[model samples]
Target: MPRHLLKLSDLAPAEARQIVLRASALKRQADSGYRPFVGKTLAMIFTKNSTRTRVSFEAGMARFGGHALFLAAGATQIGRDEPLRDTAQVLSRMCSAVMIRNDSQRDQEEFAAHSRVPVINGLSDLHHPCQLLADLQTWFEHRGDPRGKVAAWIGDGNNVCHSFIEAATLFGFTLRIAAPAGYQPDAAVMGAAGDAAQLADSPAAAARGADLIVTDTWTSMGQEAEQQKRLQAFAGYQVDAALMQLAKPDAIFLHCLPAHRGEEVAAEVIDGPQSLIYDEAENRLWAQMALLEFLFGIAA
Candidate 1:
């Protein structure tokens, strides 16, 4: 059976590590003038607007010598009366692969369940697998190894945070997430991460000696209406200079871009020294390109 990248943890530790290695090789090959997806077509399904995810996937397919067809939710019958399963069943036969960015994992899972082609989860409320690929790639590029390093997150344990926890557990890293009471990660994710954080007394204590410090917006896009409330709930959890200084001196700061100026993170810390965010953003394209090739089982 063909595999899909819906959640980072869905992959075994070995599989996740191989994706990072494969993604790196793909990056080097692309830089050296190799294009593999020539004449092929990729169907992209977007339920939300995006800057990085949109351009990265489109450019990735194109760089591999393929054409990416951008399909919007508004333009499809999905917005009117069509079922997601029906859409997936139909699209599977028309495109080589289907990449979807929507609000929920349930939607993507159902789509993949009904489709014969590979279903790439572009982004979901539960996980951002591709983004984490770029993130892990950047970590290796800058920090050398992910094993046993402390990577602390201080903010809402949203999609990105949860994915980081999963990655840390899978890769045997010390991941410390400091979120307010109501904004903690899911119980299952926390349990898995706890099983992996045995290197330290506890997860929070594990973050004290981290080599990387990461964070995200206090509230995501669709949660704008709850912005003020989130700010109040996430107080004292900002990744400001003081908090960032808690990590090792060489620690790198990462964010997925389109960051909030003062919420969750300070502007200087994100735009200043030790920030690997630009490379992180650039790696999104390369990492995703490699992921597609791997899922397709292209000749090594």
Candidate 2:
């Protein structure tokens, strides 16, 4: 059976660790004669706009000698009456794998159910497993294993936060999330995290003694209309130098990019020496490359 990484929970603890390790080796290999995807093709479907998602997957495929076909929502019949199952079945026959960045979790589930090849959740309303994979790889590069470390998350408990919660459980880390009253993560996700995750009273509280500090934009792609409201609610949640001071002296900061310079994260913190945001962003390529190799059964 083909494996589908709809969420971090899809990979067992050992498997996730192996992927991280493989990502490091893949990065070292670079484009030095590795061509696992020669003659293979990956179909990429984008229901939402993208930057990193599109570039990383396209580049990764080309690096492996594979082709990536980009399909916009309206460009394909999926925007009209073509059933997702039909799209999945048809694509599965032609492509070696499928990756989708969508607005709904259910839609991704439906696509995976009908897909014959591996299906990767490029991004979704409920999870961004690809980003989490990159983040984990970054952590492993700087520090050793993050199994017993504490990671603090600040700002809106959005899709990225949901994946962090899942990662905490799968990677054996403690996740401390501090969000405003009404902006907490989903109850079911929090419930599933159990003792591995907790809500702190404030960003400072969560960052206290943490090994990693992470935050994302207060408003995501679809929440543009609520930008002002979200800005107000997340006003005091910025991951600035002051908050970083509360964490371990060696603790690193990370922000999934296209970040607002002065909003969710302050300029000083993200641009500081301890910030690993750029490295984290670059790891998306290596991590996804490892993922594709794993899904295609080319990696041990």
Candidate 3:
């Protein structure tokens, strides 16, 4: 069976840590002309639009001497109602690996089950594992191991937050999340994390004494219909200068971008000195390269 990254928990703690370390090394040697993936091809399937995810994966493949094929769901047979299992089997036969950015986690799992090649989750409604890898790499680059650190998540406890909860368990960190009552993360995900994750009464409570602060857009791709309602619900949860100040003096801020500057986060904080959003974004390439190497059984 091919190893797949369907969620953060799919990787053992040590494996995840190793990937981050490898990513850091790859970042340093980015211009060294190394090409482990020569002649290989990665098939990328997208059910939703993307910017960073598409660019980072395509760039990573090109930098490693591999080719990447972009397949929009609507342009492919997938849009014609062909089963995902059939598509997965076909892609697995022709491609070295498969990366999918889709809305349903169940569909992703079904595809992965039928795949012969490693399957990577670009993003799903339940978790954004790839983003978590980049976030881990960025954190490690700036602050070393996150084991004993406190991370505060402010805003809707959506997919990113769910992955962060899993990451806290795997990486041995404490994750405090603050979301409006109806917007809290999935109960089962929080339960699985046990004491590693907790709920705070408010954003201020979550940020207090935290070593890392994070947030994401109030309205995600498929949530456009609920935009105005979300805006109102998340009005007081913005990660502005005041909320950031509640964390430790040297604490860093992270966001899975395409940010609503004045909404989920403040422009000052996102573009501020302590914010590592760019680094976090750039690490997506290196982290994903490391992931590809791991999936293909390539030596670092």
RMSD, model 2, all Cα superposed? 0.8
Candidate 3 regions with alpha-carbon error over 4 angstroms: none
TM-score of 1: 0.94
What would the per-residue lDDT of candidate 1 be over residues 64-128, giving only the tens digit for each residue?
88889999989989889599889988998888889999998999998899887889988889888
Model 2 lDDT on a 0 to 1 scale: 0.93
In candidate 2, what are the lDDT values of residues 201-289, reduced to their tens digit?
A: 88989999999999999989989999999989998999999999999999999888879989999899999999999899899999998
Off by over 4 Å in 2: none
- Of the candidates shown, which would achieve the greatest TM-score relative to the real structure? 3
Arranged by TM-score with the best first, the candidates are 3, 2, 1
lDDT of 1: 0.82
Which whole-number lDDT from 0 to 100 does residue 86 have in model 2? 98
Q: Model 3: what TM-score?
A: 0.99
Better of 1 and 2 by TM-score: 2
Report the lDDT tens digits of candidate 3 across residue range 102-212: 999999999999999999999999999999999999998898889999999999999999999999999999999999989999999999999999999999999999999
C-alpha lDDT of candidate 3 relative to the true structure: 0.96
TM-score of each: 0.94, 0.98, 0.99
lDDT of 2 at 95: 94
